[model samples]
Target chain A: MELLRPDSAEAAAAALGNGSVALAGGTELVPLLRDGIVRAEKLVELRDVVPRGVDGTRIGAGTTLAELEVDPDIPQALREACSLAASPQLRSMSTLGGNLLQATRCWYWRLNFPCYLHGGDTCHAKAGQHREHAIFGNERCASAHPSDPAAALLALGARLRTTSREFSLVDLYRLPTDEERNVTALEPGEVILELDVPRPEASVYLKAMERRKWSFAIVGVAAARFADSIRLGLAGVAPIPWALSSVADLEQATPLLGTAYKVQIARALVRRAVEAVSAPAGA
Target chain B: MVVELTINGNAYELEAPVGRTLAEVLRLDLGLTGTKIACGEGHCGACTVQLDGVPVLSCITLVHTVGDREVTTIEGLREHPLVEAFVEADATQCGFCTPGQIVTASALLAANASPSDDEIRHAMAGNLCRCGTYPKIERAIHTVAGDGGGS
Candidate 1:
């Protein structure tokens, strides 16, 4: 295993040319390594390389998710989510970009059961005990978007600032599939330098997991405002952080159960994301 | 490659292989045995240590991830007043979780000198004492934090 530590974001991406690269944070990649879920000949350390700016709350791909929440500028909802996560110790190690890019922690997937997520033909959780899975995009693959910070970012209309390119939240991540490879729209050579939420946006992240600590979500919620429009995103409840139009729009939208708005929005978005996919099992 | 880290006022310039976890570096290589290793995973904070003034798990924390940061182990806190409170309270029944417990408690005190019971519980929740000495642990934390000092 080789350790790659570039001096700058440009250097990092420039180094990532057309090869098997492992983007790491203590949160996602380390656990996968220990679990024997992933093997990498080239291990890149991203924490120190990316520049962190105070004015815009710049976060490097290597910075832990726990560090982001205590940033004082981060929203209260995000702080609560971070505090409620695995623990302060875990938070001290979990990075924001890594959490956002983490693969789904579904039991079937982690257990190496060869489900749809791993390129198998069948999706076990879709028809099985999927209450903990996506509540919305459940037509095929039934895994939840495991990133809690993703929900917060989605609500705030956060964007990814890649080393050589840039894309909005909706653009960067791969479209989710209930039956095939689920990925954020990250290309092979691209390195995530920093994630950006505009200075004007206010956002919050919430998740109802099984335990007090170290558990994934059963139902997650994030609400934020962008260009004066509030968007609500759900995690542990859909394929992506289930995005919806402003709550005011929903109130003005075809009136139904107020409690059922999240579920309905999740169902709608999940269908759209799955419908937009073109790959077979794993692309 | 060779990486130098300042752990608990002692400078360790060691060779860390690619993807070497911090837990392995501390207990296995450094001979600083105060930091315990229960779960190799991030959960179950038996490997908690103070890094750059914040409490973090050593198991998942890679040696390469944190560069040139100051690390405070449980052994370093031996002369601390909090440890005295812990001993007075008899907080450790099995003694396995004490190192992590002391590291976490020191971090909590450093951040907030007079944390409430809820705050103490919240900070210590990550460090699980399977021996179930929570009551005395809570009392010890309160005592060292100068709240109750366990009567």
Candidate 2:
């Protein structure tokens, strides 16, 4: 185990390869490493490598969730999503970039079960206990994307800049395929640098969690109303942060036996979120 | 890796692995056992500590990533009003979650001297009391906030 503290983003990107992992706030990666769920020969610390703070619509990826939640300049959906994502301690320690890359909270995966995500033949949750599993895109894996902010960013039509290229946030995620078991579309050595979010006319995020505070969403929805269009993104429904063409898309879910109840929660949340963002100012 | 850490107003040099968490260093190496590690993951705030005055879960925070920021543990909060308040308000059951609870509540009160009841609940939501002593904990925080000296 080695620690590489690169002073530049280019250097940090260069250092990440061949079993070396990037360390942001260590809120997600460290625990995975400790539990042996993820293995790395070296850790490239990004505290000094990546940029921080917000400049108009450009938010540096190193910005912490706590910082984003309270920044008045940040969009309402993103702020609310960050606020509702995790506990106070975790929000203070987790970065926006790292939050986007966090793995699923499925106990089967975290417990080192031989699931498809772990390169095993079977997705344990598909046949086993899947109360918290996905209601959509569960053909290959039953895990739900656990990031609340990623769904909000998807609704806001956010674009991300990496060390190599820039792309829409929607392109940053994909359902796990047989060839590639990972959910994210990021290349191995590329580092997330910043995010550009276009301001919307109105936006809101609503989450349904098992507990009132400090719990992962059972169904999360983010709605962003643009000049001519409205976009809705969902979390805890699919292997990736799910974007909906319309509220009717909620009907397309293929839920497992234990996860059938999530479809109702998704439909209700989608309707309410869209309604909240669509309402007139001060209405 | 040899790292220099500023903890509880003192600077110390030590050799630790890159993957070693700050909670491990605080409890095992430095003998600051006041910081508890309940869930080695970040789910539990039992390892809550101050990183430059902001409450963070030390269980998941890598010691090597701490840099030059000062780390304050429950031991660092000597004679703080919250300690006495927790006792007077009967906030502890088994006392395992007290250090972490006090550390988190202290940070909240420091930022907002007169936080509303809702504000207190929101801030202290992370630090779980398995004994279900939340009402007492809220009262203790309110007592220190000078809010009518607790219910």
Candidate 3:
């Protein structure tokens, strides 16, 4: 139960050498620690890491979701998705990095069920309640990405600038299978410094929630249109936020039982998001 | 580990466990019962408070992470018109989510004196009221906005 609060990013990354886990915002990590789901002895608090803001095309990973919701420099789709992702209280505490790398919200995992993510041989969601599970990349783990910003980031061509190296935003997550059930590929001691999103011609994010507000996306869509290309990202229907070059790629997605209808919802949302971003002004 | 936090204009150097949540510290250590903890998870805004003038859930907030930020609980709100508006509009049905709702609305009013209906809905989206008093809550917020006592 050792907590290290380093003042600089270098110090923080250096402290994450052993079996320590990085703690940012703690909206996701704290609960897991309290529940005994994660037993890391050391917690490296990254709150003191410098360079936190939403300026120009770069957004510090330490920036909270509340800041992103109102930041003018951010595109409309990212802002909309941020505002709709969680409740006001949660948004104020959840950081951009934590939201991007947070673990699955599946009941089986969070409730300590004997699932593959918990080192069990079988995935309970496949045989149990899986309406909210992934329709793609669900061979061993049926959990969805559960990140609204990740989908929006994928559509906006955002890249993760880590302390060690830079990689595509889509590369952060891995398609979970029995052989490798680890959620993220973030190597030890690698800290997410900031997210770099290239300005796009137009972008939009739309999520279909079970409730009117403050509910996780049943199916979320993020679409961005560049000069002659369009990028689509889908959430709540896959292990990772599914990225596609065009809407026609929807037919190539593998749909699972109990969640096949998500494909239809994703279709409509993708179309609407594309139109919202590509249509002429006041059309 | 010890942490120093300024709550409601008074700085208190409190001794708490490293992993203790702000809500637990407020309720148990400081004896501030106004802040409620419904869902230990961050879903329900029953434990919402103002950290540096922004509404944040105290339940999920770690005690050590608060650092030197100013925390404002329901008890800290001394003379604000939103409190009266809540009573007038009958928004405090069960009074479970009132502190969080008022705190969130205060932040909204601080940022925007007179927020539109859509703005109010979007700002207050995080605080959930199972009592179904949303209409009255919105009315109360509008009532205060109309009074122009924000800030």
Candidate 4:
């Protein structure tokens, strides 16, 4: 394999496609590559190619989760999400962009099972062990989106700029379709450049995990309060980070046999997240 | 690819594949067996190493992507207080995860000299002790940090 270290973002974008993958922090991509889940003939390094650091409400895509966790300028929900997303070592090596693009933690997919996401006809988790699978949007696939920060960003009403165009962060994710098995809306060779988040009046992120620390969320909720409205985003509930129109919409969940318990967890977290964000400052 | 890496304060030019992990290059090529590789994936912290003083999973970090950065393994932490503290505190069981644990703890204490018990747990959360020697590991870190130790 060839390692291409492009000095600029344009060069990095140009180097992508045609059997080449973009390398950012290498937290997610490297493991997939090593396990033969994803294949690439070349890796285009983006450490130096993409921008870093925060300028007002705009954050560079190259910012590490550790850096995002402590930056005073970042919103409280995003910082908390970044801190609670992974272990210390992983946060130090994972970038915001990479975190958003990370694949699900479904063992079936990671183990190379012929699931729907792997271009197979069956959703393995739906018929097999799916205790950690999705509770919503699981008609076709049972895998849940594993990103904590994506949920927070979705609640923050974040927008992002790519190499070719700009769009809301919500547009960045989609449920896997028969034509495209991938969950993300990003086309081939497209690269995320940066994100712009509007400051919320108040925000809170709550997550429930199997372990006390360093475990993926069984149900994560991000609630952001604005001047006259509130937005909630959920993780570990669907194939994509799910945005809730209202808390009542959670009732629309159609859980699998083994995943029925997640609906209760999501309800509890969503309640607490809403209460926390709804409280007055310092309450 | 020929990559220039600075490991343990020494610079060396090594030829390795672009897909080869930093842990593989350290163990198989440079013969630095101090850095253990248990999972080969980033799930286990057994392959933890310091990249420019920040703890990172060397198993997932590509060797070619580590250009011009200093890599520090357990061997680089010679005579560090945590090493002795680990012995006095009995922080090892099979000693397989010792190097990764010490490397991670050292970085934590470097940034915060007087971390609370909660801070210590949060920082050391990644380095799993399958033998359940967590209390002793926390004690060792606290001992070096000049604290009485955690609850």
Q: Candidate 4 residues B35-122, lDDT tens each? A: 9999888877999999999999999999988877799999999789999999999999999999999999999999999888899999
Off by over 4 Å in 3: A279-283, B147-151
Comparing 1 with 2 on DockQ, the higher-scoring candidate is 2
Candidate 2 or 1, higher lDDT: 2
Where does model 4 sit among the CAPRI classes?
A: high
**Order by lDDT, highest first:** 4, 2, 3, 1
Model 3 chain B, poorest ten-residue lDDT window?
B142-151
True lDDT of residue A249, candidate 2: 85
lDDT of 4: 0.92
Top lDDT model:
4
Clashes of 3: 1
Give the alpha carbon lDDT tens digit for every residue of A1-283 in model 3.
7788887888888888666888988889888988889877788999878458987999999888888998989988799889888887788888899898888889989999978988898889888888888877777788888999999999988998988899999889888766777778898788999999988888989999997678899999998888878888887887788888778888876767888888888888988988888858664
State the lDDT at B66 in candidate 3: 90
Better of 2 and 3 by lDDT: 2
Better of 2 and 3 by TM-score: 2
- A45-137 in candidate 1: lDDT tens per residue? 666676553345555555665666667876655665666666777666666666777777677877777887777877677655455665455
Query: For residues A70-112, could you state the per-residue lDDT of candidate 4 as single tens digits?
Result: 9989899999999898899999999999999999999899999
DockQ of each: 0.67, 0.92, 0.77, 0.95
lDDT per residue (tens digit) for residues B20-139 in model 1: 878899988988888989977877788888888788888888887667779999888889887888789999898988888888888888888998877887778788889999899889
Tell me the whole-model lDDT of each prediction, alpha carbons only. Answer: 0.69, 0.91, 0.86, 0.92
Candidate 1 wrongly placed segments (more than 4 Å): A17-24, A57-64, A127-131, A175-180, A199-203, A225-228, A246-283, B149-151
lDDT of 2: 0.91
